[model samples]
Target: MLIHGHEVPGAIDEETRCSHYHKENDRIAIKFHCCGKYYPCYKCHVEFGCGKKEVWPKAKFDEKAILCGSCGNELSVNQYFQSGYECPNCKAEFNPGCGLHRELYFET
Candidate 1:
């Protein structure tokens, strides 16, 4: 799918194959602020990410910083939160447990 005129990769189809937090049908891939790369969740970042995690600047939360791995929609952190953690485009349900790791992507 096209996001901001660029290609955003699709979600990992085999959820169990990866150590991320996505459930069997979750389509949201977190655009980790530290590396500016998308992953299924913080655990995926921890296992596959590069270097140490860097906090997202408070000012960047409004940018299209999160990704809908299903349809390649780039949404802001606020939009993601407002979405009830679901993808607005494809209506894919996100893992509810994701809330436990909010600090990985956003500042408390």
Candidate 2:
């Protein structure tokens, strides 16, 4: 599904939530560094993305790699890291649990 003009291949709703991790605050899509495509989660990328997966390099942390589903705002990796698990643009909460999987999408 498309959310905020970005394709979240396994998204189950406009908020970017997917079957693997659907919660009230699960509302961000990640722009995978490997293929430059947005996916709702790592599992979604594994299932619907290009075969290769690569974490966003630390040097590229300034790149806009996170999409806030609430207001269609694209945030740089650094911005997202500093957002306190909320969308700075729209004040929408983000799943804090996602931090546990940080290494899956970013070079942590």
Candidate 3:
């Protein structure tokens, strides 16, 4: 397990495997559970850690940073240039560079 940026030697319960990635040539091959076959297609080069479940570039984005309320954690305009306004944080999901943060509260 990772503790304070260090890994402790112990047993783990979770594991993950990608039907993609080439270790010999240092490349990743794409594999989807559809059509019963692994196929190659378009992919995004976003920073590692973003969730991607869609097709191609539409799959990757700053999903984690979207919830960051701290300044300098905002999305960049260049990313906006590629894909339009689509905030993944609060319901104010259409203002790419909005200066306002959402005040919505949920207790129900």
Best by lDDT: 2
TM-score of each model, paired residue for residue: 0.74, 0.98, 0.17
The TM-score measured for candidate 3 stands at 0.17
Query: How do the residues 1-108 of candidate 3 rate in per-residue lDDT, one tens digit apiece?
Result: 232222212212111112232122211112221211122112221212123333323233322122111111233323433324443333223332222211111011
- Comparing 1 and 2 by lDDT, which wins? 2
Over 4 Å off, model 3: 1-72, 88-91, 95-108
- List clash counts for every candidate, in order: 0, 0, 3
1-108: candidate 2 lDDT, tens digit per residue? 988888789999999999999999999999999999999999999999998879999999999999998999999999999999999989999999999999999997
As a TM-score, model 2 comes out at 0.98
State the number of backbone clashes in model 3: 3
TM-score, prediction 1: 0.74
Full-model lDDT for every candidate: 0.65, 0.95, 0.23
Against the hidden true structure, what lDDT does model 1 obtain? 0.65
Clashes of 1: 0
Question: Top model by TM-score, which number?
Answer: 2
- Residue 69 Cα positional deviation in candidate 2, in Å, after optimal superposition: 0.9
